[model samples]
Target: MALPPNSETERGVYLRNVFYNTHPTEVFSTWPKLIVEDYAVVGRLINLYSFIEINLRRLVESWTDADLLPKGRIKDLPLGRVEELAQTVLLWPEANLFALKKMAELRSLRNLVAHFGMMRFPDDDAFLFIAKSEADYKKQTGEQSVEDVMLIAVLDGPALPRLVQELEGMAQWLATVTAQILKQKADAEADVSKS
Candidate 1:
């Protein structure tokens, strides 16, 4: 599936850098490296979310044949609003809806990391979602508390690669769904013209 050109060039560059620089061996080698790798993972996750959101907006605009951003607008519309419009107007297919719902779950995690800055352990919801074992958490962080478990989980643990894989899969699924939607729309328009 061919996605439209990325609107966030700087973000794309930063994501590429983060991917190239982050390594599992380095992350496990030292505490400092672990922290940096954690930051990189969170940063990359945010960038992927932004990329998906932007493409979703573009897809909606193209399907509607109207500019989401007009001359009178002081600022662009929010992603939630755009998503609502897409659901209502475009009527996304079931597969697309499932994919978007999964993305929304990740969006919550992204918000927690982005807003809270990982100064403390993630909340119960995030902790459970990441699903780190107590024994493993104790061995890794030297503490048995859930807070410590969450701290390690968010920073450098199994959650990192799992979240990355989930996001990558979602991005690919969205691209394929978007391509199918566009093709269907084009075919419908052609059929109307024939009539």
Candidate 2:
């Protein structure tokens, strides 16, 4: 039986079609696959840190006792720019900027793999350049000649678990700093009010 089309249903189907059309086509070649895998690792790294970022934001949004603001490695910028929210970044005291720069290179390479092959995305040359640069970025950053990136995977059963554990440490350290900053701000305000 023929039926009349609902406007909402028609819109939903149209949106799906657009999304499928915009998605990048996968490259069957081996090099592209490796690059995509590397990109997945990069996402894991971001995922590992995301927890800390979210926690810090939640702390402020939840507005628990001022103690969570102190003693923790978080920077609470309360009441400054309600829109800014200001407590997104949390990093350990000795976080390695050098490693981050290298990782950025890897991510850029992966972007090419996902968006470029025979479509409106990244290109092969871009991926190779990222791989090559990642290999040598350590030297440029004045490190101990790092020829590879050590990704700490999420799933257990191998060395990846340990690496992921270490990465979490960095996030925790950042949280601690944030707490200190919040405490410092509190103390300063208390002093001002005393006058």
Candidate 3:
């Protein structure tokens, strides 16, 4: 695809292509055939989380460049701190709340999955972070036991793809918002010059 004229839009497009073109599903699908099902699940989850984190940083940096956010606030801040600022600045369209919550949950899950071995699946923690209730978790996991929850049946299944889709949506939203803010800034500058 040709890059969008807007830099922020181009960044969003690039992020989506990176995530979808990587084909995480195909990469992890082969693992189970190798009898490393746990690795498949863990690996996919970590990969998804990492991609989202990277895109979030990119989006925040774009916001800073457009003057939509104060540069000093994000300087040297951790992802969590950047996310906190995002909640306030990106709260338009109400549905953004769901996106923010999902990102936060992914961050928490990423920390646990990346640091801890798969021997201890943080099912309870995952449930708390992402699910509204045990029933909701079960619904998402198809009533699978917590022990069976991290199986490829779930990770390589619908949930992973849905997450990728959500990330793409968020990238588009961020790009659109960034473009609007930058246009506004440009207009203000032009007005000042005319004056």
Candidate 4:
């Protein structure tokens, strides 16, 4: 379900309350308040990204039962490799390929957010640079020139909250997938033991 329209306002109020609760004596200036709120959202995105990474790592661990590798090797694996392993090693059904595809998309966005700095051009605005959607590429097909290939898209103030909501939904979906895979692994092991 989508968040209520006032969710952003609600989040701002909650942050303000928490800040005041912690540093009761400090007065919040408007500029610093905005900075704090902005960073708080960024922190949230990074935290959710970490959650996705952990779940992806768990899926990778669950895929293999053998202890041939060193202890902590899986922990050292990067997100992209983990994702690739999950896609290749997991026994996903034809109907569930959508999850893997969505994962690939998420992986790209995660990389962009994790690695790139948020840039604010003085004449324009502050925005998160993301990949152009497939639909965007399609719209430019045949008319595309050497300079026409659009790789970056922008997300400014109004869209960040919605992006957070979408990421939360994705995290939930991935958790469900990981749980199902782990359960299947356990069931298979149990069946082998019973035989």
Candidate 5:
């Protein structure tokens, strides 16, 4: 039996069809299979985000007081918020501007991946990460054209692994800088006590 045009399944099928310029049934049949087959790519994307988020959380926690902001609270902070707090508090002299910038870029890319959908054209094999709805795209980026979203990264491309490596490197850099700052603070406190 065919579902009525007003049925929930029919509504879901065609809601975003205008933007893709494709029949709803094509998307309905292909999207699930594409997503499932690309499960490993999804895992890599998630892991890449986690490496940066976890490190940023740790850096923020190291400086924030447990009484004012509990460890669990810090852990739960959004990636962008944690990045902002880490930037404000961690003032070591050896901080790398490039790495910090890269971390910010990673946060933006992670947001896009989390909020948008990945799609590939019938003729093209490269799945693009893009906002499916025009309204949502405009709301997120304040741009009228969904085309402005840009081809930032591919789902299964070499860029994903490279980003993972870069994030790991940044995590190491942050850990070293945090340790040095803590040591300096402790040493200064000890000196003051002895004097």
Candidate 6:
């Protein structure tokens, strides 16, 4: 069911970020390479990215599951159902759409790199970049040599760090969303009892 206007999902974003201990810089510095150098850093990176990948897939699946409920069924939704969903997915559309979409794209990049040889890499393995979308490629500049991809080869690309930051932020959002959704279900049940 849809959330009420006053729910926590409506928390001011600044406040929400503060509440979540989620300054992007804080999360970024905690990232693999930014935090360290060498194989250990790479290992930490793989772990972080793997965490994000598995959970993101879980998130989409949970959303699809929650999406299956008929409208107005929050009251009818079994207790803890939303919690189950939120445990695996983000509850917000805006953040999930942008951040998770990019992360999934990053995962696809990793997949291609791992499965294919280093020769397939655009320039070198030194950085990772990607096309925003196939349509982005289709829209070329009038006569210039336009490329649809946004390359992260530039200094401080934020591609890897951004993914880590988003994963952490979304993880935080999942908790709040779970609580809010559960509360909504409980409130709905109370309303039904009163009527």
Candidate order by lDDT, highest to lowest? 4, 5, 1, 3, 6, 2
TM-score of each: 0.50, 0.30, 0.45, 0.54, 0.54, 0.33
lDDT per prediction? 0.55, 0.39, 0.50, 0.57, 0.56, 0.40
RMSD of each: 14.2, 18.9, 14.9, 12.7, 10.8, 15.5
Off by over 4 Å in 1: 1-34, 66-75, 119-156, 179-195
Q: By the lDDT metric, which is better: model 1 or model 2?
A: 1
- Per-residue CA lDDT of model 4 for 1-195, tens digit only, reads 111122346544544344334332232222122346666767777788788888888877875553422356688786677877766674677645666656556555455555544432222234433233445444435344354233333444656666777778877888898898789878988999999
The TM-score of candidate 2 is 0.30
Ranking, TM-score, top scorer first: 5, 4, 1, 3, 6, 2
**lDDT (Cα, tens digit) per residue for candidate 1, span 7-72:** 355644544344345463443343132256666777888888887787677667665553433333
Clashes of each: 0, 15, 0, 0, 0, 0
Q: For this target, which candidate reaches the highest lDDT against the unseen true structure? A: 4
Tell how far residue 85 is off in model 5, in angstroms. Answer: 3.0
Q: Write the per-residue lDDT of candidate 3 for residues 1-195, one digit (tens) a residue.
A: 111122345534543344345454543443223226545655766666666666566667767876778767554788777777667766556787677766675554455445432231122111111122344345445574554233211122334335655655665665566567667767877898999
Model 5 CA RMSD to the hidden true structure, in angstroms: 10.8
Model 3: lDDT equals: 0.50
TM-score between candidate 5 and the true structure: 0.54
Model 4 misplacement above 4 A? 1-34, 66-72, 91-96, 108-125, 128-154
Candidate 6 lDDT, tens digit per residue, 1-195? 111122243323333333245444542344233223423333544565565544434433444545643345343444235334433344447755565454444444344323322111222223322233333234332233345323121112334455455555655554455456556666877898999
Spell out the clash pairs found in candidate 6. Answer: none
Which of the predicted structures, 3 or 5, would earn the higher lDDT when compared with the native? 5
